[model samples]
Target: MPAASASSARSNSALSGSRCHDRLRTFHERLQSGWRMSAPLELFSYWRSSAAYRVRIGLNIKALAYVTHPVHLVRDGGEQHAAAYAQLNPQQLVPTLRHGAVVVPQSLAILEYLEEAFPDSARLLPAAPFERARVRALAQAIACDVHPLNNLRVMQLLEREWQRDAAQRLHWTQHWMQQGFAALELQLANALHTASFCHGDTPGLADCVLIPQLYNARRFEVDLAPYPTLQRIEQACLALPAFDAARPEMQIDAVV
Candidate 1:
């Protein structure tokens, strides 16, 4: 077996193990805890959205129980605009987490809320404040810089309003991804703070955002040969169960 194949197999196995454990945890919470009514969490999501994917990773990392409600983004002129979906999320974004009455919007805000609400869970940010800031910086580098410009809605706008052809769209995606990856490569290469994962031995916010952006980059056929450090970190992150489970391809609503 080739190395990549072996690696992919191991990742799939780990993902299966994580999901099995999640189900068991969920079962114990419901059956053993005597909750007959409602689940603790409700995650409004679209499977392919990377923003939602980030929140999913955070949920998995904390081992929190949350049921996903898929919202189709492209069907019927975008279901996100429907009155029902709009009521849940005024911003019309996919990842709207309902923790009791509190509706959390934005992936980063959701992650922060999870960290605060469940402080006992594995720390997503480091102990030191500066270290935590560094992690946030790395995460935002991809989330803000790379993803927004290449989002489906944005691409559609470029096509309709700006009259961009398919070739132009590809150029735009590659252009932004290359810029983000190039800067990220330099940051990761020089910073000794980076380790097996984005921050240290364990995966953090940076790893979560990085993996999704890399997925998009590949989808756009962006040459990753220029960003070896980013690739190495992605490989390291995906080897772990939390990151593997959050992969776009593994989502329940994934096309393939």
Candidate 2:
């Protein structure tokens, strides 16, 4: 190789390394400064969506500022099905989170990401491994085992494909919620770890997941008298400013 070419190659490599170093430094500075990025976080949400509701609570608890891009689920046969939004989230689900170049779908994943990305901020998981697993089990019980059965898409499918009426839909939602809440009530009522919230005194992942499902249960007129423990925790959570502010009615896109 020519002497001049080798020198040019060395200079280019040095410049690339310097650029990478600068990028990392900037990112570190942003993380240390409470994630106050120039781009800001963006959330694709539907106001009444339980999944979106959970993410809102997590964001509020973390005290993170974010921009809400409302995706109306009903109007014009569901705006989430539109090409542009579909490209952002192939699942066409509400509560897709965009953080700069990183786009995260699913509410639980978003909550976990926030906990990891901003460790200096409020934590959504406990420090103990066993406690963390307990919290996650409770969260998944609602988010995975229960909420999916009663979400809008499932209701739509029942109506459109199975020709189920509103009364039938209500029964469907109520049955699943009752089963889930019954189990949750038993766990919380017996567990020594349960405190003011699901896992401890502070509201964490389980609380964030639980409150939204309770809201849905109320919306569908499910009987809550059986789950006194859940109701008590719900009251404790709603009294907090973070959970209060994240209510579906308080959202900017809420309908009357």
Candidate 3:
């Protein structure tokens, strides 16, 4: 095998091992504890939506199997507005995870739900309360601060409602991404928790969120040269099977 192929095989093996461990832990929880860990899962998502991307990474990290319902955000005047999609997600968002009968909307909520629903999986958050709070804060800095201003609806409103052109929209996207990234860069540079990943050496919830935000940042041409720590962590994440498998381009509905 080529070097890249060998690396990929190793990553796949590690991912499989992680999933197997999670399964055993889940079984222990089921027998020793009262938590129901297994259920049919369905994720309604769009290929390019960064919010949806975060949930995908979380599910993959948990080693949970879920069906994908691709909602093409730009096709047919946006399918999310249709009554069928709205019934499942009142907000008509791209990432609504269905676990048997329980439906969950919002990417962060879905991440938290997966952690709670599959407690035995590779932990997305730390057990230490202070460490967990730090991770959550990092995740929110990107998901809440950076991503919200660049939503599809927000951009569309800027175009049609405010009569802005493509250049203006791009500027709007880049501006917010830079602003948020600057703060995140500072935190990561100075924080003691910063390691191979956002919170620690292993990939966790903050990583799940930050990687997607980086994808969007690149899309908008936000300069990332100043954030060496952030970029280093992202490279580490992209090497992992959990993160690579959940990339937007890897989705079934991804267009050329």
Q: Tell me, by lDDT, which candidate is best.
A: 2
Better of 1 and 3 by lDDT: 3
Candidate 1: tens digits of C-alpha lDDT, residues 1-256:
9999999999999999999999999988767334323448788888889899889888888888888888889989988899987998899978899877678889988998888777778878999989999999999988888899899999999999999999999999899999999999999985889888889988888887888788888889999998888999989877878878878788788887
lDDT of 2 by residue, 36-147 (tens): 4455889999889999999999999999899999999999999999999999999999999999878999999999988987777899999999999999999999999999
Instruction: List the candidate 3 regions with Cα displacement exceeding 4 Å.
Output: 1-38
Task: Report clash pairs, candidate 3.
Answer: none
Full-model lDDT, candidate 1? 0.87
Per-candidate TM equals: 0.84, 0.87, 0.86
Predicted model with the maximum TM-score: 2
The sequence of per-residue lDDT tens digits that candidate 3 reaches over residues 28-47 is: 96764442445678999999
Clashing pairs in 2: none
Kindly give the stretch of ten consecutive residues in candidate 3 with the minimal lDDT sum.
30-39
TM-score of 1: 0.84
